[model samples]
Target: MTMDKQFHEILSDTRQDFSGWDFSYITRTGRMGSQLLSWSYGSMAIPLIRKAKSMLDMGTGGGEFLSLLSPFPKEAFATEGYLPNVPIARKRLEPLGVKVVQIEDDFNLPFQNRQFDLILNQHESYSPEEVRRIIADDGIFLTQQAGGLDCREINEMMGVPLNEEFAHWNLETAVMELEANGFEISTRKEEFPIQRFYDTASLIYYLQAIPWQIPDFDPEKYADPLYEIHQIIRENGYFDVSQHRFIIQSRPK
Candidate 1:
């Protein structure tokens, strides 16, 4: 098939409904892969989850990750800010006695003060004061965050403008924010891992799903750059990009 034909076909196939926070298609196609982390976030969270009587999972996208750590606390609750993911999360987690809440904003948590003994957050924006308000005096907060510079290489490859929102959001900034909000930081780690995309299709699909990476991204609008990237991928085996991530564990001061 011609390169143009192949590009169009890949674009068409990738433009599907990306619901439920699942990336099975990206993985199944064997087009995208990432380096493994040195430490397991799930393993670190399991013991903490088992010990807490009340737990809250922030931005529990489709509750997929939270569901795996099941046999939850007696008061298990999950909050999803994305409208599409809220219903999906409810469908998956409600059956497990997990109350899936739809939160309109991350700044304000819709719960009573000191409502939870443990809060788990993954790739979610949060208000530190709000977290401090809702968490028990001795509660724990564990979060795995996507650092601001995550996937910057992709932006450079496509000539897209870099997002400055997370430019200063690193381990130091996170620790300062948490401590400033009355939390004592116990564990902190950050990593910049390599993410490899073997095909242009995976890259397009990822950009489509994550609009924040390229705020004005549209396959049609970015056809030129996308084509250029596809040509580079055709010449090379894969495209490489850096992915920034950080994990922090803290308790009320």
Candidate 2:
């Protein structure tokens, strides 16, 4: 097929509707793939969830991961910042006895002081002070974060500047913030794993799923570059980039 036709075709194919935090569309289909991190966030959280008497999953995207931890504590709860994911999460988790709440400002979480003995946040934004306030003195706050420079190669390839707002966010910064909030870090880890996009459409789909990668990415706006990358993919069979990720587990001092 012609380059123009393939580009338009790829655009149409990847523009399909997406929701929540699910990436199975690309990942499951083998379009996009990522190298394994040194640690497994889910595996690590399982034991913590099983032990806690009461736990809160901050920013539960559609309650997908939370749901996996069945037989939750008597007072299990979850909070989601995105509006669309609220209903989806509630529907999936509420039936299982997990209360799902919609949250907005990270600094002002709507919950009683020291309400939870365990708090989990993966790829979600949170405030150290707010987390400190809501967590019990013995509570564990475990989070896996997408570092400021997560998948920055996409930004460079698309000709967009990196997001400066969170450019300094990393494991060290997070540990410091938690320590300042009177928490003692128990474990901290960081990794930069490779992510491969087997096709140009997979790359486009990824950027769509993660809008913050290139804040104003439009297929048309970056058509030339996208096509160029697509050609590179046709020649190289894959496009690789590094993903920055960090995990921190802490508790109140």
Name the TM-score of candidate 1: 0.95
Candidate 1 local distance difference test against the native:
0.89
For 101-210, candidate 2 gives per-residue lDDT tens digits of 89889989889999999999999999999999999999999999999988888878888888999899999899999999999988999999999999998888778777
Model 1: how far is 219 from its true place, Å?
Answer: 1.0
Error of 2 at 213 (Å): 1.0
For model 1, residues 85-197, the per-residue Cα lDDT tens digits are 98999999999989999998777878999999999999999999999999999999999998989999888867876787768888889999999999999899999999988
- Give the best candidate by TM-score: 2
The worst-scoring run of ten residues by lDDT in candidate 1 lies at 1-10
Task: Give the TM-scores of the predictions, in the order they appear.
Answer: 0.95, 0.96
How does each model score on lDDT?
0.89, 0.89
Pairs that collide in candidate 1 are none
Report the Cα lDDT for candidate 2.
0.89
